[model samples]
Target: MEIKYIEKVKKAFEMVHTKKPLVHHITNYVTVNDCANITLAIGASPIMADDIREVEAITSISSALVLNIGTLNERTVQAMLAAGEKANKLEIPVVFDPVGAGASELRNRTTEQILEKVQLSVLRGNMSEIRFIAGLEASTKGVDASDADINSGLAAGCSISETIAKKYGCVAAITGETDIVSDGQHTLLLENGTKLLSGITGTGCMCTSLIGSFCGATEDFLVAAAGGILCMGIAGEAAAEKVGKEGSGSLHKAIIDSVSNMNAEIFTKRAKIHEA
Candidate 1:
């Protein structure tokens, strides 16, 4: 990553606190509360309304929209389509999270349906989910990344992230032990997070929410994506240090605290981003 890109990330981080943009989410119920709380922690407002009747209205008023298929259902999927299309028309950035893309027929079909219909500004998911979306062979352990896929490491992640970005014309973010964010032209590898992040549920969903929060503040999708993931990674590291032997329960709360207290100086100094 260049100094300019780091500056951009810093600026986006500041903008989120200053603009306090509203992020509308048509997301999975499983991590919905954490998503909303994380958005707030990052200095953005979150409104989670999946009702098809009101999704358009909610999205129209939001600065950004997040669509997550974590806990998929027929009705919410329609709402996601409605909100996504509305966000496109309004030019509000939309971030899509293909939570369990390769796990089941419903998830796979829903992922395809959203990609076909929505013009996503950013597509974020685990390695396996992203690989599946990129038309590569992927093994998903439910909504989690398969151990084999996780072991594929950075080279494979960079390749798949780039492939998905080019294929979808959106910033692609593949999060794991090492995070890859690509916008076809520019690819960044972020190596900031801890393994403890993976031990907790909703961390991935919260990462998406953080990205959505940043997207609400800026049109630079690549910066927004990087900033969000970097924030989560840094927060995870901070939480891990603070928690010690207190366990994951304490780490979860500490993660939120770390995010809420994140500043530009901390982010710029601690971010582990590199050009790929």
Candidate 2:
């Protein structure tokens, strides 16, 4: 899975540890614990709150902001807007995760609202989520990909992603066996990951959280996006290597362990990103 773009991603891995940052999140409950734990493991502090009163205060103080629509509700939606607006005004970077975006009418509308309300720095999600955000027809299961080509089935999902990024002026990242990231111009392809990632719940959500973690430290939106994807990929590979056969549970822990030990030397030796 080794590739040339690995070096670029590796340098970003080194920067994060040297400059620990604060990441504030207003995500769902399903993966909130893992998201927070992973953020901390990746050398960043995570604070998740949807309280309308505190969201603005917290966003104003954090290094990065994350908004996830995994478990959306009227009350929480309002909170997201409040937090995201403050993050915007304060100029802190924001990462948006449109989890299960095409799963329902409510989800689709909510995702659009988020984009309209906040100027996102990065949009990390599956093809279905990205496609839905791009104003294209898409379908999805509850928080997961539905049909296995255009939405969630394509080999390289950047076609829809590129269009979406340009429309919003943000980086769009679509993950699968190979990951695709583009700002409607340069697209980065990453190849470091394992099938075991799909066997775990909340991994995608955690990946988005890690993006915010890295963005907190480095304002380079592209590097922050690339670093999160490759670092998580590298960690998953390392975790699988360290815990050979115990199963996905052990592999998940190893992934976190690898992130806690993330560095350029380790990443450069393990990353697998390349030009698409």
Candidate 3:
């Protein structure tokens, strides 16, 4: 079973580098640069077009679309809807990042609108965001995830993720110290990341882009999302080892370098994924 998952993950990475799938993104301006850089770092081409006029056209030509609501507004919201609708029509996978879903009423309402309108392939968010989207009690500090221990450990997170996945009919991934990915029936518990990852500003946004790249390469949303999360976790640990005492500045650059230099050997050796 481990070998099967390893092979699938390796193939997804190879296809991204070899096929170079084009991923269309309707993301916020705050982490737009990081999103594009991470997409390229993972050997996938990214086209960032949030303009409503061209979003439909851009999504039509891409293999996958990523819709992120980090810095949400009316205009970008419209663009996201247009791009998502087009992607649905083309039968391309769509990865959604519901950033800051519990931060404000505007964000909450907008997220609800997107979920109601678009049929997502994967929904990725932090614990607070996912809980809020699931209509559970949760507190968020801006876009960052607050310290949470609802019913303890990853099991609690898995239950909530499974519920959301079943509701949306898509793969749901809740990322934190121990990332959890679920497809309503099967739940995955992945432990492979560093504390330094929380210091980065756009790591979550970049994660969505990487997941979009993986989804573009394969039809299995579950494996694709797991591969993306695992890649980030392993790359984070590798970058931390290289940075030594340089702190967040060097750690950020090293992460991109790690992703660019990532191979099957490193991933297969370092990945820590389990069926929950």
Best by lDDT: 1
Per residue, candidate 2 scores C-alpha lDDT tens digits across 116-136 of: 999999999987677667666
Lowest summed lDDT across 10 adjacent residues in model 3 is found at 147-156
Error of 1 at 39 (Å): 0.5
Model 1 lDDT per residue over 1-276, tens place = 467778899999999999999999888888999999999999999998999999999999999999999898899989998899899899999999999899999998998999999999999999889888888889999999999888887888888888889988999999988889999989998889999998899999999999999999998999999999999999999999999479999999999999999998997789888898
In order, the Cα lDDT scores of the candidates are 0.92, 0.82, 0.90
Between candidates 1 and 2, which one is better according to TM-score?
1
Can you list the residue pairs that collide in candidate 3? Answer: none
Task: Give TM-scores for every candidate, taking all chains together and pairing residue i with residue i.
Answer: 0.98, 0.93, 0.97
Candidate 1 Cα errors over 4 Å, as ranges: none
CA error at residue 13 for candidate 1, angstroms: 0.5
Residue 53 lDDT, candidate 1, scale 0-100: 94
**Tens-place lDDT digits, model 3, residues 130-191:** 98988888888789877863334576798899999999999999999989999999888888
**Candidate 3, lDDT over the whole model:** 0.90
Q: Which clashing pairs does model 1 show? A: 1-275
Model 1 clash tally, residue pairs: 1
